[model samples]
Target: MPYRILKRKDLIPGQTILMVVDAPMIASKSRPGNFVILRVSDKGERIPLTIADADAAAGTITIVFLVVGKTTAHLATLREGEDILDVCGPLGRPTHIEKSGPVICVGGGTGIAAMHHIAKGHHQAGNRVVAVIGARNKDLLLFCDELGSFCPEVLIATDDGSRGHKGFVTELLKSRLEEDKEIAEVVAVGPVPMMEAVAKVTLPFGVKTTVSLNSIMVDGIGMCGACRCTVGGKVRFACVDGPEFDGHAVDFQELKMRLGQFRTEEKISLEKFRGQS
Candidate 1:
């Protein structure tokens, strides 16, 4: 059966949206890091989204996404009561939660939605949760208050100084780490460059860090081999093995190159989509 969108709203006008889907099976089983693969229509490409929240008792899964690409721009046009042709999940491995001390959850851009779940999970697991979220400007920012609800301390950063600290999110993380915060573990989700920067900053501090990778994924399962990446000298699939991995062991440089391989095709696809829209 198709998953219906019970509710939908713009978190950032024309840019990002929060969608509540009627997928009880996925909601009941989903964990913090688990994601879902959805198809807008029969011919639309499968778009993978991280589960920002799940209300099992209510039989709904919440997802947040930015309208940056063709598929996402199309998604923004959808309204409440519309149905997603296919939604196959909760897929991938769930995040490993524990009572690790002083957990820092870092997010940039649309990744803040995913980080919200991770930060809350850590807090519930009895860890001191700190959140750092950022965007290009204040209008583009998201989840600051939502994150504050669970995280005891929430920090903000923005590239244009429209709100919060006037710098990259990594700068805030580095400054905080330098202050001798006893951070036991970190969970980050963002653009590849942002995650790479977070990994670089934490590597010197000897802090355990995990980053969720939004690699190219065709199937919600491992059969497509589209979401493969190298971690600690071993090949791993983001769909089945993880959307999360040890930051220190990840080969980020290679991953960065792989993410850009379809730039030309993506641009052409986006242009065609916009024209048809």
Candidate 2:
């Protein structure tokens, strides 16, 4: 049976959308930090997207994605009741969720879209979830209402000061760290630089930190090695091993550089696709 788009919510007009697909097995098995690789058509390139939410009872899972390239732009064109060719996953090791007290989860930009599920997982585990989320501006921010429902406290920041604190999310995180909240652990997921900055800010406090890496992937499995990165001096695959890792031990600088390697090619591919259209 084809995986049908059960529901769709256009979040940022041309930028991002939330899709609920009919994938029961994947939904039942997926956990926070797990991702899926999807192909919109026979020739479509497989794209990895983190699971934003899942409802096993409904046999559907939610995925939020930005329309940055050919594949995503194509995916966005798909409307409700349309079918996606393949939706393969629940891949990547699940986040090591635990009862770590008073945890801080920081999500910058599109990362905030996926943060709610991860934060919900922690909240259900008895951890007080304090969320700090930001985007370049208020128009780009997401998940504040839903995340705020489960989390007793939610903090927001915007680069343009259209809504919350007028600065980077990292600046807000730094302020919270200084407040003596005894934050037991931190989870930062966003742009590579944002995650790196969060790790650096929490380093001096010696707070345990984990970052959900968004390294590019091909197969969304170990076979391709496209998502390989140096973590704790060992080669780790973001697909099979982890989408989340020890922030202090991860080599963010290396990951950052590696993420840049395909940008030019990606841009070219995007341009070519646009020209053809």
Candidate 3:
């Protein structure tokens, strides 16, 4: 039997699917920051999405996804009780959280789903977690209240100042750092550009920073090498090596280029899909 959808939500205009599958192994073993590869049907393309929430007792995992492509949009059309043809593990390396000091978690756009798990983990680790979320505007921002509940502080920012801060999330982090000296580490999950901005802000301060890369992933296993990323002049695969890495060591320029390699195709596909709808 395939994985069945237990629930589905349009969280902030994006598709959020909560699926219940027979993978007791995955739910029992999943830790925060781990992701899974899913296929809607045998002919569907593989896409990677982070686990927003999980309940091991019930053997369920919640995956919140932003419908950004043909596959994702197709996935959003699925309804509760429908089954995903293929659902693979508990993939990617989990982030290590500890009560080291004040931790700031930053998320942008659809990255909130990924950040929520980390924020929860940090809070459980007894770290004072400050969650900062941003989007182009209010509509694109999701999981603010949910993430806020797990963090010591929650800051919202938009490019247009529609919600909280007028500037970017990095600006908010910068101001917080200026006002307080206790920030020990920063974990960011979002678009490559946003993570790069936050990394630049934290680099000079010597604050330990980590970022989760969501570059296109095919096989969740490292064999495909599709999710390859460069860090400290060494190439690594995001799937097996890490979806998380030291922010300071990541070559953002190269990552940005790689992420944009299919921009035109993606845009055309999005446009064609939107036109169909």
TM-score of each: 0.97, 0.97, 0.92
- Per-residue alpha-carbon lDDT of model 2 for 27-143, expressed as tens digits? 999898899998987887899999999998898999999998989988888999999899898999988888879999999878887888899999999999999999988989899
lDDT of 1 by residue, 1-277 (tens): 8889999989988888999999999989989999999988788899899999999999999999989889898888889999888899999899999887898899999999998988888888999988998899988888888888778788999999988899999898998898856889878999988998999999989999999998889986899898899999999998898989999998998888888999998899999999998
Summarize candidate 3's per-residue lDDT along 86-126 as a digit string, tens digits. 77889999988878989999998878878998889889999
Q: Quick one: RMSD of model 2?
A: 1.2
Query: Stretches of candidate 1 above 4 Å error?
Result: none
lDDT (C-alpha, whole model) for all candidates: 0.90, 0.90, 0.85
Error of 3 at 232 (Å): 0.5
